[model samples]
Target: MINPLGIVITVLYYKIAEKIKKISIFSKIPPIVIAGVMLIATLEIFDIDYDIYNESAKYLTIILIPATIALGYPIYKNIELLKKNKRIIYTGFIIAAVIAILTTYVVAKMCNTEFIVIESMLPKSVTAPMAVEISKGIGAIPELTACIVALTGIFGGVFGHKILKLIKVKSDVAIGLSIGAASHVIGTARCIEEKRESQVVMASVALVIVGIITAIIIPLFIYLIK
Candidate 1:
């Protein structure tokens, strides 16, 4: 049986998130987080089965691919800027990737975390889909990788700008790279909301580059380390 209530709940939560975002103080809270909390509360109150809800709402997840592809428009519009800053962009991407991997490894080691746990965390900065694939290739838990990736996105989307500002990162490219490299899609959404086309382009570009690099390099790195 089709669950229309699941779809209705998703739509209503999104609208509520939009409304919450319009308020002054709550404006900084990421809409996804608001929608997530609302969804959980609603599910509990209504005693909805998550499995059934997810099955009915699976179409929403499918739309993410096209939405990601549509980011090409912004990248095309700022092609000149991307070309002009190719050196800086690639440098930032490599450095960010290295730092992400190293930090995860070191922290996991310090905690005496399992090797598989460390491996899963290696791709934590990338988007969930890529991270999950990378986790699988490296023999890590995909579900754990997805959870870490989501938490990273939520944290970065909420505090990324403030962190960049605190560090005096005034350049749009640098800000975009930092946020996108650390947070993925959620961070890109935050950039889009800022209405800065250049930031949006660079963030999207960084995300794509990081995803590719993580997918390729992380597997090789894991092999070498093993």
Candidate 2:
């Protein structure tokens, strides 16, 4: 029998790509729509008759790294601006990252969730792939971490622009910080769409800063909870 996930992903990936190419709205890249289609395709098409499919997915996931790396060129183009606004970019990212981990930890503890679960939730503010790696390093559930990451991304992508506008966050630097701090890669996409080159650079800085902060803090929080 043909692998179902392969068939489904093969079909829908192209469809989604086509839709994205043709559309020009926020709905074009809704994470829910993308992820929902992916999940549904996985279940319906992938036979799951054995554990091999799970193993194959690992190799597939590795391909995403190159895409992440491609983001670096854009950052390189704006490196001069980054050098100038170093303080603002670093300061905002550190504050946002710390708050994200601390808030998740405190809330998880208050709700009596296990330490590992909290550790998993700690990286929810980052991109999903990065969140999964961070979760694994800290002994958290990667799958659960992925779900949280997706939810965070969707929420950020869907409402972040409106929220910034409502709050009168007019500065491109500030807007970029908010998107990177809150939504990770999805937010970066939003920043670039506004034609703000500096904001895009700041968004990259925000993700890096937040990723580093989460890496150091999440593990310590897990230890403390243990």
The lDDT of model 1 is 0.82
* TM-score, cand. 1 vs. native: 0.77
Best by TM-score: 2
- State which candidate has the highest lDDT: 1
User: Could you tell me the C-alpha RMSD of candidate 2 in Å?
Assistant: 3.5
lDDT of 2 by residue, 45-136 (tens): 86554255545445556765675566467657767776886887777877888888888878888999976677778898887666777877
Model 2 residue 50 CA deviation in Å? 7.3
Task: Indicate the worst ten consecutive residues by lDDT in candidate 1.
Answer: 66-75
The residue ranges of model 2 lying beyond 4 angstroms of the native Cα positions read 1-28, 31-36, 44-50, 64-76
- Position 186, candidate 2: lDDT: 74
